[model samples]
Target: MDDMIAGGCQCGAIRYSLAGPLPPAYACHCGECKKQSASAFSMSIPLDYDQLQVEGTPISFTTTAFSGRAKHNFFCANCGTRLWHSGSIPPDSITLKVGSLDDSSGIAPQGHLWVSKKQAGIKLDQAIEQFDTQPDDVTEWRGNLGQNS
Candidate 1:
């Protein structure tokens, strides 16, 4: 069994607990990510959807991703803090914005994605792998996984 990670929105109105090790975290430099975060990039941890449980309802806004997939951005309706994002990947897995976590010190991004959209003056360490676009290998693997079966 994996340890549980507890977190919530800034206002504590939306609480969530994620069990098991989070999937490899990624720093996304896509335009939409930057726009939403108002930063150079957005860090996220992808976890099985069923493994995530929220205490309150989160507002969702659907938008087209760079891949042309319909991505839903979920946030605490009260505070409007972006909490998680869901897309066409697997219903069992959704990406949680790292910023939403109460304790983010344990989470470190393993790599950077959508490097092509990265902003200037944002220097990334050489230790992590950088991809110009979404990693095809991860997509294939996620697509093949059965949803909470």
Candidate 2:
């Protein structure tokens, strides 16, 4: 990905620009993620909260994840397209949906999380590490990606 990337919702609303090194993408297979994404999993790239700039207002809903931590899900009010998620789950960073990127060309998930809640029939890459649940520390779970400073 570029040092700076741009993306938005399905419609024209809720545009965002991310500047700085983009983290490798990761997948979450928890039930809430599957339900919100309507897919086997939700793919996201974590960015420093200060590195992202969002334009236009997004309707947000707060809910607790399988981890029991609260999160605020942001979506386009017009088309209701899910965008990014923010909250206590990751603390200082916002989880930007990879699919929302204007160009997702070379982006791919580096690992999988919440595999314990993964739905049946879902298959994951055996090459990448899969966590039954969140690791004790993000650093241990994401390797160097968690070393962001």
Candidate 3:
């Protein structure tokens, strides 16, 4: 069993716990991600729906994803702090927002996506895997994360 980790929204209105060894996170540099994070990139940790336990109701909305599929965004209604998002990749998916973690000091994305849309003057880690666009090789992506996919 892995250690359990806790996280919450900015206003502490919505909290969540994920049964650990949290999966490796990836940095998304897509235009939408940049717009949402208001930064160079957004970090995300993918998890199976059952792995996360959340308290309090989170408001959500649907948006068109880079893949042209519906992506559901969940955020705290009170603080407007985005908690997580759901992509159609696995009907019941939850991609946790690393920024929401109470202690995210250790988060370092293992890979990068949508570098084609990355902002100017942004330099990525040469050690980790990177893709100009969405990577088609799932196994390679997992392997880059040190997971045996």
Candidate 4:
């Protein structure tokens, strides 16, 4: 709760921390996200991949995305709770599910992505930004950390 974002899986088998303010959070209404989360949409915070630090190894599941790119979902191997996802975009970023956060009080979706696939009944509030697709470039939004392997 000290401004740094931290969270883990349901059983505490995996943990992660974000060193700084999270990039804008967004609601992804893409079909791939919905099926992966088993929900109407997936709430996520985009972070430079190097900014993510995890305490445990997560089980990985790979799937071809709607864009035909390969994506890997990482989850707590013990609790079966999805933790984060990587691939298709900059390998330097990972979309962490907001539900996995330890404290999500200040976190809110700034916009809706892949809105075309959104459910008919799931209307987004007017104040939030909406994009038909993901942002074109996030190079300027890189975190203040050195590259990580």
Alpha-carbon local distance difference test for all models:
0.78, 0.80, 0.81, 0.75
TM-score of 3: 0.88
Worst 10 residues of 1 by lDDT: 140-149
After aligning candidate 4 to the native by TM-score, how far in Å is the CA of 19 from where it should be?
1.7
Better TM-score candidate (2, 4): 2
Q: In model 4, which regions exceed 4 Å deviation? A: 88-91, 132-149
Q: Which is the leading candidate under lDDT?
A: 3
lDDT of 1 by residue, 1-149 (tens): 25888888889999998776666677889888999998999998776678887798888889998767888888888888998888844444588888987777877677788899999988887777778887777565434333322
Q: 47-119 in candidate 2: lDDT tens per residue?
A: 6657778799878889986557778888899998998888743336678898888888887788888999998
Question: Could you say which candidate leads in TM-score?
Answer: 3
Off by over 4 Å in 2: 88-92, 138-143, 146-149
The predictions' CA RMSDs to the true structure, in order, are 4.8, 3.4, 2.9, 5.7
The RMSD (Cα, Å) of candidate 2 is 3.4
TM accuracy, model 1 = 0.84
Where in model 3 is the C-alpha error above 4 Å? 88-91, 137-144
Q: Which lDDT tens digits does candidate 3 get at residues 85-136?
A: 8865333767789999988888788888898998999988788778888777
TM-score per candidate? 0.84, 0.84, 0.88, 0.79
CA lDDT for candidate 3: 0.81
Clashing pairs in 1: 49-92
